[model samples]
Target: MNFTGVSGQLQFDLEKNLIQPAYDVLNIGGTGFRKIGYWSNSSGLSTTEPETLYGKSFNTSTRTPHLYSVIWPGETIATPRGWVFPNNGRPLRIAVPERVSYKDFVSKDKSPPGVRGYCIDIFEAAINLLPYPVPRTYMLYGDGKRNPQYTDLVGQVALNNFDAAVGDVTITTNRTRMVDFTQPYMESGLVVVVPVKQVKSNPWAFLKPFTIEMWLVTGAFFLLVGVVVWILEHRINHEFRGPPREQLMTIFWFSFSTMFFSHRENTVSTLGRLVLIIWLFVVLIINSSYTASLTSILTVQQLTSRIEGIDSLISSNDPIGVQDGSFSWKYLVNELNIAESRLVTLKTMEDYIKALQDGPKRGGVAAIVDELPYIELFMSATKCAFRTVGQEFTKSGWGFAFQRDSPLAVDLSTAILQLSENGDLQKIHNKWLRSSECSMQLNEMDADRLSLTSFWGLFLICGIACFIALAVFFCRILLQYRRFSPETVEGDVEEIELPPRSGRRSLRTASFKNLMDFVDKKEIEIKHMLKRKSSDNKQEASPSSDGKSHSPS
Candidate 1:
């Protein structure tokens, strides 16, 4: 018989008539098998010469050697790729786990609708990514009311009882050993769920508004403003000059009183007034912020947790709640070394709430340990009553299960990857996982109240103002010292030099020291002269041992 192909014409004869190779020829064929022998191309099949194979040729010189050996047309011995249901139109059996807790991920009930959830939506969307349609029907893997063991659901696929298993099945090393899993559509990890309560009032609660660093910085600025004010005012402002102890008290009183806008002493110098203006502005901002923060702390109810994380639960003799038939029970025992006595099996979200509310003392668990998705769903329903403490500890992903080395795993995995890239996966996730009615509750943190970083710029402005004022004040003092020398200010006297005590003093240093001494003496004389004038005014205002008042004349 003759056959035509893109290469050229070829002829086939019965396998029995073909000359066999010199080596042993194994006759392992049935009646339907035939062999091709001759080619009429420009270059015929060749064993030694490469040109004969590349260039077309008619092999008239010798019978064409067997170019290749293959089963005759219309005889297929290899199994086909993909799901090939027997011609009876049987749909693919997809096993969906009946989850008691977090039914939003997978729910199976007989009330009209059978199977539905986040996992279901993701699976259907992924199947659509394939070029061909997959006829599938969801079969519940457990009795409709209880949580199903995921291992059993996966095992059915391995045993050929089901075509595939879907719905929140975590991929593990042991499960993978039995069946292949597609790339995960949802991330999974364990989280600690605990009940929350309002914080109680205490004596130290007043100090909760500002961090320690913030308080220290504020106190240091109070002293800084006081020092800067006295430096600028002491020379000319009579209120600033008094006994050393009195002057110290005045600096303290003036700086703090500014907070209430009740400082009695007035600034006399122009630069002193500028410094006060900047300080008052900074004080206003600080006062308003502190007032608002402290008011919120006192008026609002704060939420806190005594159990910080898994470590806290392990150290205590409290019972820990785990979802019944979950992977958490084994993880808590084997990986975390938690005692079985501390484990409590919770089958529903209501069970979780009751266990946490009763507490360990009242026959309840201290905390519920479960996967992140389940805990998040519970939190959404309860809203503000519970919170997840600490980070996710264990790591895994939810994936679909298939028979071992099934080609469907690769195609399904590719589809999931496409869904993730094009944002279809997130759309499915938001449709089921996110709740529009639940308002996310955040813990009121002390870090949010107030910090030094918030007001550093204002403080910088005030500091710069004080620095400029002090610079001007010092410049005036230096000018006065140079114009009125010590010899001229006091009575003229012969100069006498004393030897330095330890460090040798230069002429410039000695002159500066003498000028400072002269300034101090002049300041003292001014104070005494003012005191004498005050006394004279008092004496004139009064009568000498008589009721009549006396004038200076």
Candidate 2:
């Protein structure tokens, strides 16, 4: 993302079917796929667009009409771990066990550490579907952190060939005849590039002729406006002819000046000037009519205040930006094959955030990041600093990559399944997304929402107080009856007939009668001994449970 200000991460452009092999009929890249994507249908009947469990498109920000969307693959019950055969091009993701995250705290980076990203979400899901310990450090290239060198310096040598096995081998159609795949723990692309141009501290350092697209569009607009004025002058002045017509001269100047930055135009033969004037007026009028249309194409139009999308950032090639060596970069590189010299590599998302605040042109990395929403914020806080390129390039599944054939994947997946079955998956979602202090603040935004001050514990406390008071009141009434009419009925003949409601009742009655007079009679007398301490402003004090002397009011 090229968005500026906020240091965001993980705002990836997610498109369905961007996977390496694309999508086959057997795969999910086709029309059947949906993502942070949407689906809708309309005909003579009606239209529908349902909300998925993520609440994506179900709210006011996204006016998606109601439609039926599936629950998350890992969250759903009755799912097959790996192979149930995809239907309607949807893969069934069944994890073995569900694991909720620690929702109480956010890391210093503002992103959750220990637990993070598509990997965390999909890893938990994959654990339920696959056996674990899937894989160890396969191989490493580039430096592990963003220091003097961001990539693993010695390349594969850094990892000691833990990832040496399958570098380049093509597959024909042989099952048992050759090397095999353990199981695809994850399916996605890989990339990390260098920006082609040097990033300037100030984002707007270069704009003379303006961008190529802007120059063309602006010139055309001016020419069209001149043409319109020329037509109007001609319409009314057809009956007279003169070397100096105010309207015609004004139109000429406006259209001509739009050609370049020079304020004075002195080089032109009489015939050339005439030709230039007529042409300028003609073009200006034509361009004027299409201003709205031209406005849409110019890059500057879209990026007036801040950078708009990912492409501008890449094309700008500021040295400041970097992304992980994930498939997104690979698409921008080897596959998309952006200029190699332009690409810069960073080890993690952390580096991307740190460099975003430099002067616009300083680092030359106008924009850098994988996550989209996070970037939106990152750029916003930076005074609308960067921009984005366009739509998502590819869509792929993210899961915990494991050692080729590890059973631990199965165990983890089982744990995920168990959690999901018992509603733990949802609990985790609510916990992380809703329990934040941010949520508490948001709740206070209106009278209808719950706030931190209105926490449920407060209500529970009130209820307990009421219950205790009621219990005391009832006990008092029971004791009063024993004292007021002890034996008025002791001689009643009817008591003889009922046998005093014996059995358990008789035992209860006897206990109540014996306790009628039994009570804690010791008086806790309070003698007000006001003592003024040296503090001048006296505050009430009392003896604490530990017998510490406390000052009084």
Candidate 3:
């Protein structure tokens, strides 16, 4: 159907078959509505405009009504034909959940016969923002003995037992199917809460400074340094020269003692001393890091939860707690595939604390699973004895509930968004849920042990230094071998020691291994000759200058 006039044409589908009509209309406000002139039915009975549609006229009568006056942005004008209450301005009946899981949300005072809480404050604030007054009375929904089910409270509104329901009502898909929910005032989601315990002492706590791979790498480096130093020093240094078994034992002893700077053996070769220098530097860093990590472990108090996340709870046979009538129970049983027998229903904040503290073995739950708002409220109210584990498993929000398609939902949602933008929401939240105890931070150092990554740079530097020294040592050995070879021997290069006639003859037929042995023997002989010359000099100096030489003292 279509209507054309001096005003723009209004087109709509008569059969509702089009994907989209010329206009989409909602009854809440006229800020977006356009006037397409007027219509009249001369023989029909009169009808008043709906209370929701702000600018459009729904009235029909025998006489023609005036055309709609344009309503501009930021302006609201009264309709010539407006709705009036049928029952003499009776207050709208609003249901407030009684004995809610957390009393901070909503609580009815019997002595004063009134209801007040964080939710009540927000509801009043939102209603005040609406253009017109919404007179309403709070009727408690459940008996004081037990907390009321939120779904039941919302159901009453669907059945028209109440004009609306308020107080920490969650906006969920199933609930929204029966009622409309305003924009969420409080962002929320499901979280797991578990009691935090001090880490227990372990007999092998000493090994925590380094991971197993780090320990193995460090040990390998130690043995490598020892062997390299022995190779460089054994020919010249008496301390390094020994029987095969003694030399092998010395390698381990010298390597392990370098950690404490207590090795008795001394390096005589420059290469041996250079290797020790780099090894000692690397050991210093490893020791310092190990000490710092071990000190933090021993001196600091650390808190942790046994339950890491939803998966841990699902796999365990232990009982888990949920608010008595919350959707969490259904999510755990149905969505997570957990056994119903493993769930424990908790009715109050005290119940949550008691159940968690007692633990699953003592007829209580190992953890409490609930929405963030309720969990945060519980955390703020108590000492820092519990903590949340992992991310929220489910996403949802808290909003006020109204009968299906109620026009008030849109305006109320706008008011809530305004509150959020203007900072009133934060102030309200702080007034109820903020606590100093919740400010304490967890110690991350407790769980992080040292790994090879932390000291890889030091290891790299030491390894490079050893390789460079070995390269120099190998080059000198190659130069000596070339100089002694009969064909390569040059007249300008003076030999330090001549090979025996038989050894020289053997060298002509010697393999690479035999040549290495000949070089080793020559170096040892040179060291011995130097030592004997030093001993002769000392003996000559020791003799007295008298004609008769006394025994050398």
Candidate 4:
């Protein structure tokens, strides 16, 4: 058969003696053109070669012509040649690791082998959202008997052994150099896993938040406030004035009792009341903070790890565990400058748990350093037997791997970003990691305590208020002493005066009479002086006066 510009001529070989139509005309837009067969060259096609074609008839008035196009058997065209799905379909070969954890992605238990898992679910979901159909086949890369390194799994895609590699493979510089990676679907980082130790209850744990010095200083300030209140009120207020021993006892009792709000004594003087008010406020703040801190200490367990962080691991003589062939091994040796002699190589999550349980002294490591995903998975399985400590370091994330410059990489990355923006990625993570059988144990090593620094401002304000009250009381006492001292000195001089006498008896009697009369006159003079002084003070205080008093001095 031969075809030309939408019209073709068909002829049968005389040797075969086959009968067929001589000519057939077809239009692009006419009805009755039904597809019969398609010709696609899957291999060895060039620009100069004739393009593949489909057979159809356009004329309803004539019988459907026998349609045929040149094609080699078992050959087919690729799907969605650019961004659109081909009329037929394209087969996508995906590479996956063969380990038990990753095997779910390509399990063959289903009718024709179906893919399912954290990674596979994401990939399938992304494909469904595409503009066209993409039929895929998952090819297991490693032998089922042994686990493979993520590097080896990704290398298969780099070598074009498969179209793309998808799993928990993390994106790293070395891997990126050989293959392109989509945006990370899972956040990843390194963490330290340590064996859980029993936290013994301390009898005095309530006092752990504040140091001994802080307690002692706090007690001293309480006594000091009490003494200040006593000094301001001792002479005038009966509640404070007493025998030296009784007063000393009262001061200590009131000061310490304020801590518990149990003081029964009341302040009668204004200055004393002011000092008590400031002291009460200070006590209120201190007591409140102490109660909060002590409550936290009692209710929450104090978790302590033998090794606190990566730096601690590096500085100590104790051995540490690093997964063999992992990036962490290189990180410890090169980046952290840790000696290989102090390093113990671990291979799997089981190894990590075993090594930590055995301890550093017994042929095991003090801590295990591995990726956070693995640590989380381990904790999920072991429950409270292990916990992750320290900050996540050497940050990286897990992503799908593809051949360098592969066209699929861009589309896959865009799909992943869209999935993340729409919250589908988070839902997948919750299904896999959050809903897993293993629950994460809480770590309390980082819980904070209330310290003196948190309430020092309250104490400072109280101290200033107390000082002002003390100053006002002292000034009032000094002014009263100056007003009364001169009158007492004048009375002493009047008592020493007496008139001359002849006989001792008459002289004594006359002197006594004169003394009585002089005492009466002096008493009258003192009364007049007191009244005049009081009236003068009132005149001076009156607002109507300009600069002088209206009454005589």
The residue-level lDDT of candidate 4 at 452 comes to 59
Model 4 Cα lDDT, one tens digit per residue, 1-553: 3334343443447565422322222222122342323222221122221123223322333523234332221233223435543335566778876664423323333544455577878887777665556567887766665556778777778787887887778788888988999888878888877777655688877777665656877887898889888777666556775677998999999889988889888777787888788778778877777786666666543334557677777778888887654567777887888887888877656777778888876788888888877677677666657776678877899888888777677888888989999999888877766433433343453344555566678767777877888788657644533454333424532333344554566656654554433333332354565577778789878756754566567
Candidate 2, residues 1-553, lDDT tens digits: the string is 3233343222324664221111111213324554333332211111322212323323444453433333433334343445332333332221111111111211112343233332244344443445212232222222323222212221222233222122111111221122222223233322222222222244432232134454465455455545443432332233211344754565667556644423243322232234445444444543443352323222231222133344555556445344443333444565555765665554433455445444245553544535333343333443333444445444432222223343443455566566557776566545433321211111111222222343234334433433454455447545543443333222222343345546568656755654433221111110111112212223333224324544453
lDDT of 3 at 97: 84
RMSD of each: 13.4, 46.3, 13.9, 12.2
TM-score, predicted candidate 1 vs. hidden true structure: 0.63
Off by over 4 Å in 1: 1-83, 109-113, 200-205, 210-228, 239-253, 258-304, 435-553
- Total clashes, candidate 3? 0
Tens digits of lDDT, candidate 3, 240-314: 777889999999999999999899999988988988998998998889889988876765545444577788877
TM-scores, all candidates, are 0.63, 0.28, 0.64, 0.68
How far is 217's C-alpha from truth in model 4 (Å)?
A: 0.8
Local distance difference test, each candidate: 0.76, 0.35, 0.75, 0.66
Whose TM-score is greatest here? Answer: 4
Deviation of model 1 at 320, angstroms: 1.2
Best-matching candidate per lDDT: 1
Ranking by lDDT: 1, 3, 4, 2
Q: For each candidate, how many residue pairs have backbone atoms clashing (under 3 Å)?
A: 7, 118, 0, 3
Deviation (Å) of 429 in candidate 4: 2.2
- Provide the lowest-lDDT 10-residue window in model 2: 521-530
